[model samples]
Target chain A: MFAEGPSVFSRFIVCLVLSFLLIVIDQRQQRLESVRATLAVVLYPIHLVVDFPTTLVRATAEKFSSRRELRAANERLRAENLELRFRMQRYQTLERENERLRALLDTSVMVGQKVLAGELLAVETTPSAHEIIINQGVRSGVFPGQPILDAEGIMGQTVHVNPFSSTAMLITDPRHALSVAVNRSGVRAIAVGTGSMAQLDLNFIPNNADIAEGDLVVSSGMDGVFPAGYPVGVIEVIEFEPTAPFARIKLRPHADLAHAREVLFVWPQTPEQDTPAAVPATEAPAP
Target chain B: MSLRNLRGTLLIGLSILIAFALTVLPLPAWAQAWRPAWVALVLMYWSMAVPERVGVITAWFIGVLLDVLVGTTLGQHALGLAVIACLTVIYHKRLRVFSQLQQGSICAGMLLLYVTLLRIVDRFAGVPVPSVSYLTVVTSALLWPWLFIILRDVRRKGGVR
Candidate 1:
């Protein structure tokens, strides 16, 4: 039974070459995304099975918590909810006024976005790739490039959507970048992930820029991926290097990337509204 | 195929599935870097146990499945696992006669080769280099003896070959 067909070396070479071709095709083009997504449908069940132990542990913990603790948590949530409701009333009035002003200025009104809530399933194990798998995906109308947010601020965007789950590339991933503005001065710059969970880098800002430590940074919406005015981070440090023309600015992300369990998937306005005309009048020119 | 052969194949398939599940199980952030290469170990066992039936192709298929599960480049694991399976097939005869400790050392070497190839491909593709986690290889090597016993038990129970 052991001494059969193709020699081991020949079999190895054939499979190796085939895999090399797959690697080349997958890396260079978008052709394999559909294949990957299809395969993900099959893989989703295995993820659920793997996640079962954690789910069971959480459920058991919840069951064992004291009634007094549950009541306390409920009371706290109600108080927070009441506070948010009051703030929302004020925000509605301000939104109406802003729309009227935009009408007066003959600019298109900023459209309200629809968002779907998603529970995070898992975080990727690789430290360098800061990504999370969320429970929402193509079946729930989630798509690649959809902005993900938490209660505090923007988290990241979905990079791959399978049938039952989507993988979001966190804003703190080294490969990710988004256009951001210093809220105090409306100075625009690209905030790039520094591969660290706690920090983001604002690059290409001149040494003389008006940004100061502790200033808030918000999405500029110039890239059209993230909606404008969403809080992204707060400036933590601004260093002036003797050799470089730009200041090295680092920010602490407002979103709790390390602990977020639930996130919002925002469907941004269509690509037509992403044109230059939609940019706010005070936006700084792109660097 | 005979009933015994079918049972053997099923056992092999079950082992692979278990290996994949173990590979993806969530670990604490501090423990993730030390995860043993479970899939590679299982593939190595089968390739050595039944070299002709479970050679490079089976390893490649399992590797691709792992790549998809881990969400990496499609062929990344396939290449490494295929090479390792080929090596196991070439040396299975000599390996069978060696002591368990000696076999464990060779398994560590193969795991090192797998990690090295994976890192080289990642570097060439411009993915950020992972911090050195030779602990993964060390842990996998340490587990090889137990894994060998368990798999041998399964194979004998299934009456494979």
Candidate 2:
């Protein structure tokens, strides 16, 4: 083969230098986000092509289900709906009381929270990074740092949002950590992912902390990323040593992090940022 | 360019698209790590077969596409695939003379290097890429000989050269 225009060695060196610069830019947070978003739009077709087969099989399976299977599913949903309605009734009264108490305290009352439902894209965005893509993107108002959830509880937060899709890092990713409080005792601690979907490690929890095995863990809302009171995990194990400064506490996350097919993108900050303050100011001017 | 050359180029693009498609198709839970790294294997074949066309630039751009596909940092795959392409170019003459088994062994080494480079870059980027581990190395190596045969047959039949 004849030597090409630039020669292989020169081209290789150029590409290496260029890519090294790109990785540096990409690693510094959102500096490369706009470029990624543009490139992601071009690559969107690749994702669609890759996703076709999985969605097709899923759709076909749902369509070809037997009447008995459909009936069983319908029955289960109906029973679940009834149970939810009972809980809804109780929550409605609690919500009214919460507003009255807030009015007495001269604090802004909590409004109904908003969430956007999204299906998990079939692509494993980053297998090692514990990143998952969702079909919702910037077009649907999805934004970075939005908390993600499943039916059970807090899952992760969106790290990058493209035009057609968004990538979320799961809470179990080693790069991620969350602030959580023990629901029973309100002890605050940092929960760091253990690189396993099934477990998270709580840091700086003293041996004498009020937490016990089976204690419920919920987000503390202190970090401003995840809202307070969402179920995060249940403590499964705690080991203490006499010489150690902190106990080793293991938690099993409530969200089915590994298997969830649907996720909810929550608007926790939107409430305070857009609703209560603006509503009163606009209404008072009319009066 | 002649019709044959154009068709050959199309075939290269098509094969890669198919590899990308295979990547997103869900595997059974236990078989996730066992699935061969399709893109790596495809690039290994192409860089060796047509080093003139699929050189470091092509490999780097394809790596960029993969980065977007998998949501990694922009240049992680680019750097890894570039290394693979560069090595293949430097060794293409000797590689052509080698038997299938020998070629596959070298391809396995390249694949392992590509994966390891990715993990190292991922570590630098603050993403810990454990769990999948080096299992892909074994699977990609196992798939190498068969993939080489199929691609070689297709290239010859289609007059890709």
Q: List lDDT for all candidates, in order.
A: 0.84, 0.82
Stretches of candidate 2 off by over 4 Å are A1-6, A106-108, A271-287, B130-132
Q: Estimate the TM-score for candidate 1.
A: 0.93
Query: Could you tell me the TM-score of chain A in candidate 1?
Result: 0.91
Best by DockQ: 2
Chain B TM-score by candidate, in order shown: 0.96, 0.94
Provide DockQ values for all models, in the order shown.
0.51, 0.53
What does the lDDT come to for candidate 1? 0.84
Best by TM-score: 1
Point out where model 1 deviates above 4 Å: A2-6, A123-125, A270-287
